[model samples]
Target: MEDGKLTVRAVERALDILLCFTDSSDLSLTEIASRVSLHKSTVHRLLASLEGKGFVIRDASSDKYRLGFRIWELSANMTHSDDPALILLPEMERLRDQLDETISLYVSDGLERVRVQAVQSNQAIRRVAPIGARMPLHVGASSKILVAFAEPEVQQSLLASPAWPAGLDKASFRQQLAEAKSLGFATSVEEREPGAAAVAVPILNRAHRLVAALAVSGPSNRLTLEKMMEHAPVLMEAARRMGKMIK
Candidate 1:
């Protein structure tokens, strides 16, 4: 292989390894190898390289790999430049107050959705999601909205996975996505979290491509399925307004 091509291949593989951290907080060498579709030795070699650069490190307590401080630093800096989280913060707060539920903003990362910003619900008994929570693309309302509006390949890859991840089943997830597409919105009722339900709508950019998802989540007892359906239009409107403000 040519030198430049070889370098690109290595870079891609390294990035693949880093991507494994999206859904996993810690994983062993064998687990990382399986997730990344690489041999154990290859994973070890790449991990050594990353560890040297302070991007990844093995947990001394559990011997599992976790992203390192250096990686967090880089991600923080990149977030500042992209400014997606910051741009959406004001709107998220508004949505949270209007619905009195957790409001979250998520962006696609490969086949997963990463929570970039989250506002906690004010109600005493409410659903709470942290800022860095990672969710499967097909599970919750927010994630599905993000996936439904994404490139076809991105949605197809998640459907084609041989084994579905936690909080989602393959066949049911496909059916849900189809419905979400038809409705031009997404919803989940007691699917992702127990006693929790949500409605989500896709945010699009000037190019009419998916940029993010805006979601409102609360306890199912309070945010009934009927009420969620009622609020679907509200979520869509917020998504549209946020999309316009994004770029």
Candidate 2:
């Protein structure tokens, strides 16, 4: 019984270490030790174990630890289970058919947004994002909408992080978020990926908290700014329908 208890405690401690990476991308041994209230030696040992398991990787130059691909693999697996992707697939397909452009569903994961599901556009020239693609939250319309409607704490946290957009200051970013909220959707043109334009709306839960973002993307030449605005109502309505269905 003591052995079992020790194992459980160890698991909890490891989880604590992993959770630390959610807010900060990299950490030194001392930083992690202070964050988890563990001795430096203990933290070092835990990090070693996690490293062996491919959960963390250390930078050779900085010696700071960052989350590894294993975490991304596990996260991708979770996106398949108990996620709204399945429920949103039909809607995505319908939206794709309507616009003849790509439709994707994105959810926030730490400081990034993951494309959980997507229906590619049938058009000869269109935007296409793979199902498991992960991208910075400050880059695209889908990600920005997710950030805009997120909890105030999350918004503030992201705004203050180094991952925040380099071109936009905190005040400007906040204003953009406010504008997205006021407009009920977000739009981007050649922001993240050149030649791609997108319009997105937040999918909210019954409590009106953001659950995900639904976006329509296509070639900028075809999906011009005017076209994006024209499709905003359709995307917003689809988002609302998804919110209701998921709730």
Worst lDDT 10-window in candidate 2: 74-83
* lDDT tens digits by residue: candidate 2, 157-213: 787787665776778667888999999999999988788899999999777878899
User: Per-residue CA lDDT of candidate 1, range 1-247, in tens?
Assistant: 6999989988999999988886678899999999889999988999999999999999889989999889878866664644768888888899888888898888888777889888998899988777767777767898878777788898788777765666556777678778888997887888866898888888887678788888888888889989988888988888888888766
Task: Give the Cα lDDT of each candidate.
Answer: 0.84, 0.88
Worst 10 residues of 1 by lDDT: 75-84
lDDT of 2: 0.88
Residue 80's lDDT in candidate 2:
49
Candidate 2 residue pairs in backbone clash: none
Clashing pairs in 1: none
> RMSD per prediction, one decimal?
5.3, 8.5
RMSD of 2: 8.5
- Model 1 backbone overlap count: 0
